[model samples]
Target chain A: MPTQRDGTPVSVLARQLRILDTFDAGTVFLSLSEIAERSGLPMTTTHRLVAELVEERMLERLPDRSYQLGLRLWELAARTPRAMGLREIAAPMVQFVQGQVRQHTQLGVEGGYDVVYLDRASAPNAVVNATIVGGRISLGASAIGHVLLSDKPRAFLAKIVEAGIRRYTDKTPQTLDELVDVVDRVRELGYSVADGFIHPAARGMAAPIYGPDGRVLAGLGMVVPSGEPVNMRIVELLRSAARRVSQQMRAAYIDPDHPHALPGAKFRVLINSSKSSMEYFEGNEGG
Target chain B: MPTQRDGTPVSVLARQLRILDTFDAGTVFLSLSEIAERSGLPMTTTHRLVAELVEERMLERLPDRSYQLGLRLWELAARTPRAMGLREIAAPMVQFVQGQVRQHTQLGVEGGYDVVYLDRASAPNAVVNATIVGGRISLGASAIGHVLLSDKPRAFLAKIVEAGIRRYTDKTPQTLDELVDVVDRVRELGYSVADGFIHPAARGMAAPIYGPDGRVLAGLGMVVPSGEPVNMRIVELLRSAARRVSQQMRAAYIDPDHPHALPGAKFRVLINSSKSSMEYFEGNEGG
Candidate 1:
């Protein structure tokens, strides 16, 4: 994407987006110079655009004259159907599950070859987890990620396997054969478990959330410190929660006002209940 | 901007965004007709674009053929600096407080005339709250919203007040003068208390978090049932957390790598933490 100083193929809107994208989980704010450098725009252009954006409230200038993502973007993004809708429905249920298990609970959706966390909740004293809400993990690495992968066609899985898995820890399954086995287990048991894979000290149990047509929509999982003997109790809890969520989804499907319904389709997928599906799936799967 | 049937001001990108924006805390998915109607685009265009977007994996089509915000946008937005970075720094602190308080804990930043929730953790059995993570609330309404307003100049407050306060419940403060008093008290107490303002059965306590220059960067709050008396212990915990966050902001400010520091500014205001100053000034003027 690099180009001669002024000949960059980047559109003005893309450049502006690039400037915004420069901020991420690691970097929340940046100086004008830093933004210019990261966006690879002329310092003058970056300054002018940044000023305009700030004026539009798309960027906020800190007391020190540093810039961060404007609340406007967040507000606009809040209107995004997928993130906010799923979050609203899943939140209370996630809270319920976290309360019961006192562990790190997360809701993730499949995106390409990875799983992106949309919502995550844990007790203050819960185990530390590598996944953060609004963060992504490889589909081959974490149990939740792999559960999403397992729901996809085998051809898709092969494509992902072809793309090397970056090992986060020694326990991350590196070989394609091992990954295939894991995927099979996820499909067979209707859940997946990763012990000390993503983070050396963390273990996770995850299951798929299905849409009305029985397609996997997302994955829900819980993380805890490693070395806890695998127990049926946790599995049962997660499965029950997942089942409850699925029922809610089915209810939404039958509701005439439900947005997911097609013009004449008999049901809606009910994205909101996906969290409950996660909980229910985990609970039943564990049992 | 509307145009003749032959030509429309709405660009392909804007239409694409509209499809995504149509999904919110309430609307998660929609059929082609709903998409076209809500976005004000023709069915042909909506169908074509939605199909293309689905191909790009930027939108997902369910078995019923309705569309939801594709995981792609969530993935990309996840990389957006504001959502990820602020949450990372704030999560641990929020988690700690939630552990101690066992109530609804939230982090929010001002977005235009509203507050965009970044992260929230609540006691599973805590009071039902209207606030949702990644949702928006009017600036003149909630405790967090007012905390942000407390940092703005008087002229800015006047503009907002003139714009009008959306009353969500009977207890919601309507007049600007009344709101000014609320802001004053928030400043005096180093925090804010919202009683049945946003939702009838809910109340909240919030404190501002500062950036490097001691400006209010964000607001952290908790929600509880309305009838329950204000818990001083939770207030103390929130205040302490806000203070420690302010210290972190200061450290970031002094560091050369801090985003807000200009090359050589003699004085800097932390944008997110200046609520105290604004509140103090307002109180002195008999706000």
Candidate 2:
């Protein structure tokens, strides 16, 4: 159980949230007992909280009395600028990339130690893509993850390195030095190319999308079939798309009162210079 | 504050939900005072709850110290069978309709007294559509709403009538008789054609999509320019698309252990016959 700074037990709100956290991509439905066990709460407390959650429509009781996450949560999340706002603005660009490449194109934001996908567009028979909307990939194992973490502080990077990276494939970075090298390359090139890092059958390339504050807000990428030469044309397409999305984010955040402006303390305006990668991309793209 | 049947005040979960409910599309950001005011909670209670919420990432604290619904909520909502599950299965059909019609095509399910859109595909220059994914339209006002309400019990329909419908345009249903007529027409025709009901410049048409239980689960629809003559070809395409989606739902629900089967008390196995609307559509489509 979670405790406060004073060593007191957490509030009912914390326990309720613990219940919600139990549901994920694989575990969508759970009986009361399952929720109780997964949440590590007493059965009576779980029952009381579950009753209140159902009454509030945060959780829906199914036909067989199993519980699932409810629509009310989605309804509330729709108003979240971080997820849906970024998605609405970046969707057209993501769609364009998918249309041009006929592969799996996606946008994802940094969520803790994972890269959480916000939107994805896939062709009917596109190359294998394990990612889905609202799904997560480890921040150390994917091209998009490299781009999202490119702007983080050295201390943060060291912390991630200390935690250790999972080995998904032979090409995935397994050491701190290799991970740091990848992050530095992404910062220098304004994009990342991961060849068969997640899976041997696929290659992923991504570029950083900037917010109005000029920080790396998200990563836009495409997953194409491996066994072929890397496509620089696709990399350029992704960079151009990311630039367009970044321009929109700038416009959206110019009005500080605009509800779509995502709030983050680490956000900073990107400076334009010969050395700045964003400026370098704009020069090459003639934008 | 909401109370239980025994007149006891609702749980902290309910109050926390009340805080969440204060957010909407227009009211995405809320200051501590604003949340307290909107949620009708004491300032101290609101502060404590807000602190806990931000700590849990249920609400994100912005740079300016205002709060917006957080990505955690979206992550949780992504596991909802009613929203994301239905959306994932129905997306391809929705895309097909949108591609064929070059207009706004969408899928929606009944939520309380409204039809909540789950997914939408729109051409770049499609006719104006007021709906967005996770947005709502009243049951008496739109074609999608008509089809979604077609399977509900009479007492529920009467309750909706008692609440009265908002008239968005002169063509919208003005009385209980007109609303009932619209529902009946949707039932008989296996689709709905709503002309200028929501606005003068847009026309919406829809057909019901069924769940594995054979009950009306959602509505798939298109919005196009209002002045053109009703297109029978579009209606036929919509009915066919709905049928395909229903078949997928049937396949999905065949396994009792599947996580995507939505739970609802009113859901029933749809029977087939000459007079059944679903059967009639299948026959017309030669399926």
Candidate 3:
């Protein structure tokens, strides 16, 4: 029922995309009727468009005659250059964190008002992590979300604030001021901690991971059991891991297009400052 | 120029997909005219479709006004259930292979005639692996490809053979009969070895990983240097890792709809036999 300008029906392409948008994490397999209902398009149009989509391999007909997103679409997304560089470089760091912490370690980036996880490495007995690779979580409900949103524009922050929050747990930020306060602290401390913000017995922590350009490329973090206080040692470990990944990102991104400016040069300032925090943490080891 | 069976023009959906198909790993960004040329569509139609695609976030306009695959496509692809289970469940096993072998470890599945890599973990100094995640490799040119195609139907195999071969190196199988022999060997030996098939100095090895249904789900593999012969120890490592991944895939895939068929039961037969191979290796370690 999405209308176009001048009160006309939406374009054919728009109508088609609506069908694709209907299939989500939960509704991976859907019948033709279900797709029509979710898309809010008529059955005739839905059937025609879906037939075309299947022909294009954008959607695959399942064994039970339902539909799921096709491997062709996944193949196309797999070749995206920006995602390739960030994910390939950050994967080992996330793997290391998963090994050492024995928890659910994830890497994510800002995607509008949510944190879109790019990659995750989970331990065998890890706590439930609501965010999966390619999945998103609201900025107010995730530690990674806080890390991703910390460096965004004030207007962008204001816009999401006006949208109203949907609280998942008692610890989730429920107001604009509360959300901004956490992001401000994340900026100041260069990390975020959210205890039971999504699941009541899970604690999540995150730190900003920068690209070669020293921009906040993604958030690297882990989810742990909330039986004890959040571990400061793990937070330090996460930051150090993020720092190493950022360095590797910088090293790999020396674009021949911009030969004079080294990607790692700008990040040195942050690294130097982080060393002071490392020293401070070392001094307070017993705390 | 794809046409309908009646010799009429294909649908608008097919035309739009042609534009997306034009942008592969080599051609990530293209000018409007380039898109039109590649899609073999009228310039006006290409322009209109690209505009709608940009609006839909299936295709993004670059800063320089060229087009690239949008992040929205990646998000949708990320939620694909089959890829989700395979990548998430198989990642840790791939990571372990990367650590032990100090080489490129990858997971792949048969996509039509080609093997499509699901996920990979690479060592910094590993031999070059041309097939990346979401990228495709011919069944004739990869160890993983052999592992993936071994259990498929004869018609499926015949269709790929009829599609013709594109050789990358001298070691690559050039005839359908040669391809079949290798796949048969892979089936009998419970593993595959393709030395310098894709690249002159690289040795690729693979083993099948089964789904919870005990069907051949994917191929877990690694690429190492072809120096000093293909090491038996690394092959053992790869098979064990694949076996472990198959177990995890089984443990996680218990759907009631699939009752009466014990998940991974057929694969357990492989695992039990593989243990004897492990013992054989342990006995021959001094060799």
Q: Please name the candidate that would achieve the greatest lDDT relative to the true structure.
A: 2
Instruction: List residue ranges in candidate 2 displaced over 4 A.
Output: A4-9, A99-102, A123-128, A250-287, B4-9, B92-96, B99-102, B121-128, B250-287
Compose the digit string of candidate 3's lDDT tens values, residues A156-196. 77777677555767778887788888889999989998888
What order do you get sorting by lDDT, best first? Answer: 2, 3, 1
Per-residue error (Å), model 1, residue A175:
5.4
lDDT digits (tens) for residues A1-287 of candidate 2 = 47867443487877788888777655677889988888878799889889888888889997788888889988888667788777766766876787798888889999888899887777656666657578788888888999988999767777777777777689888777888998999889889988888778778899999987778999999988887887889989999999998996765543444332323322112111111322223332312
DockQ ranking from best candidate downward: 2, 3, 1
lDDT of each: 0.68, 0.76, 0.73
> Could you give candidate 3's per-residue lDDT for residues B1-287 as a string of tens digits?
36877433477777777778877654566789988887778799889989888887888886777777788888888766667557777777777788887777888987777888888776545565575567788876789988888887666667777786667678788776888888889989999998888768778899899877678888989877776676889888888888998887776544545432222211111111122322332343322
| Candidate 1 TM-score for chain A | 0.83
Candidate 2 CAPRI category: acceptable
Residue B50 in model 2: lDDT? 93
- lDDT for B151 in candidate 3 is 87
lDDT of 1 by residue, B101-137 (tens): 7767888987667788887776546665656567677
Judge candidate 3 at residue A258 and give its lDDT.
51
In candidate 3, position B45 carries an lDDT of 83
